[model samples]
Target: MNAPEAVNETDAALLAHAQRLTAQAGRPAPKALTRLAGGRNNQVYRLEADDGPLVLKRYFTDARDSRDRLGAEWSFISHAWSRGIRAVPEPLACDRAEQAGLYSFIEGRKLTAAELTPGHVEAAIEFVLAVNARPRPALAPGSEACFSLAEHIATVERRVARLATLDSEVPHVAEARQLVSAQLQPTWAAVKAGILSGASAEGLALDAAISADQNCLSPSDFGFHNALIDDAGKLTFLDFEYAGRDDPAKLVSDFFCQPEVPVPLAVHEHFIERLTQGLGLDAASVARCRLLLDAYQIKWTCIILNDFLPLGAARRAFADTGAWAERCAAQLAKAEAKLELVGADDTP
Candidate 1:
């Protein structure tokens, strides 16, 4: 299928713009241009440069604040490169004024649902392990991860409370409110207990803890979909919009939650093993990381239900709020089981 039309600007116009920008930088005009197929947050295009190929990312400028995220993306990709993490595309240049940037286009096959096989799972785990091995890069003086566990939990609690108050107006609001209220308190309690008990201390000791890493560089979003496999079958990761110093456990948690795979307990164990091997983490530290991962997953699920599910845009999906609640409950139960297993292990 032909790529979607460039939404913000016509292709001819964007091509002309790219030509001007490249010429200004003393580079030749691109040979070909085509829109890329992922991401709802940014406009991406593949530009075939004279030397080879480069990916052009134009930041959404409709909102004043939306344009500001480019700087963070630049900081992340550059820092990751310095630390030898290949999880990010090689950023070439960023023009904040133009609200656009360029990076090397990794040549690989985009991962689809069918590709989420056992072999692919092993590959994905290895890639994440390599990323986690590196120390998280320090955030710029005042920069922070988008959210923290404490803050996130508070937001969920507040939203759930608001839903409770709106129950009479919305049809399923009461059910969602109850579903959220029932779990909010215990989930928050578990998070607090985990934090106070130092269950998440090892990889989360920095200022932002898992939210922001001190020396470790993390991709803002790491999932099977964002990863690609080259002809050689090696994994090449892309997308750095959410890349920053985050809790290693959070990264693992996001991976486990990816829709592309069914996260069985064995898969989690394999991830820990490969991650430790790739990142040079000790066994004890890996076990500790696993606990933090379970905690982070539960925290994320709560955010999805209490926040996203209640929003007008997402309410339709919760038409059967009872069903949604059951699924969330099931996932939580699994997470709890994993937590118990990892928490009881004496290795870490």
Candidate 2:
């Protein structure tokens, strides 16, 4: 990450631009700005103003990456706020051309894994229910949203294929190559076969898309990792760059499968029961979710190795996340840990 620098010519120009954008949003101009850390796909800054604080996000864009991140987040937050879902950051303003967005700053500490609790999970579940409540608005599918089981498997395959192409000998490249070729490839094949078998037993087509009602207005990367615990103990969720219409089953799986802020296995059953019941999901959908749990476990394992890919590493570099070798080694360990859990058949 770049160190805080004195206001040089470049800094002055960027700060002025931020202030201009804030003023356009009908918010007070920021008197000062500080670059915030922990962002992995964009540049985030804390903009200080007399009225209060706001967050300025300059999203990462590339010719290879075509997802409209700004549009997805702005639309998702706006719709949720319109529906009286105040558990998320308020969408203040955005400049599509600039790929920048300003949002109400949330004053709270990000939750640690140990800080995760049943209440937090319940609140998250409620947020999901509220977002998907009746009178839903029309929106695009989430970033890489998978409606069918086949799509989910195919997504993992594509990710693994990318990792499979890594031929470098730098840092953890050899370990990642071994994991992908020896472990990930075979594991994915087994997972795909298992998911297909489960789908057949449930009488669901592998490629059949779920009905719209069964779809969710998902905060695609939903979990405590994307949440902050305010002084009032309110869990304010953040980062909806990938949020939009998605499979509720995928949401449920992701909530548990995410490595950071690990939700205990004990809470898994309760979460599944509550979420499935609250969403009014039919038995088949619930069954499908059970089958997809292991599938998503593998998907997340692929996600952990994103740093090994060129575009993925580029995104991390854009966010100023340093220590690439350390991060790659650590991510490989985490991916291996997930593989253990996936093999255990522990989670329902």
TM-score of 2: 0.94
Q: Each prediction's Cα lDDT score?
A: 0.55, 0.84
Best by TM-score: 2
Q: After superposition, how far is residue 42 of candidate 2 from its true place, in Å?
A: 0.7
Model 2 clash number? 0
Where does model 2 exceed 4 Å of error? 1-10, 167-170, 345-348
lDDT tens digits by residue: candidate 1, 1-348: 114344434468778777766665556778677776554456677877778766778765443233255776788677757768675688777777887887777777766765667787776666555555544445542222323444433443454454444323334445545554675545656665765456355544323322132224456456766777777877767666666655454566566654333344456766766666566554334544555554545444443443233243243332222344455445444433433332333232
TM-score against native, each model: 0.62, 0.94
lDDT string, candidate 2, 1-348, tens digits: 123323232478778888888878888888888887788899888877989878889999989999999999999999999998899898888889989998998878878888777788889989998988888888999988988877888887888778777637346898888888888888888988988888888998888888877887889988988988878898889899998888888898898899988887677778778878778887767887788888888889989988887788779879877777888889999999988778454444
Local lDDT at 247 for model 2: 86
Clashes of each: 12, 0
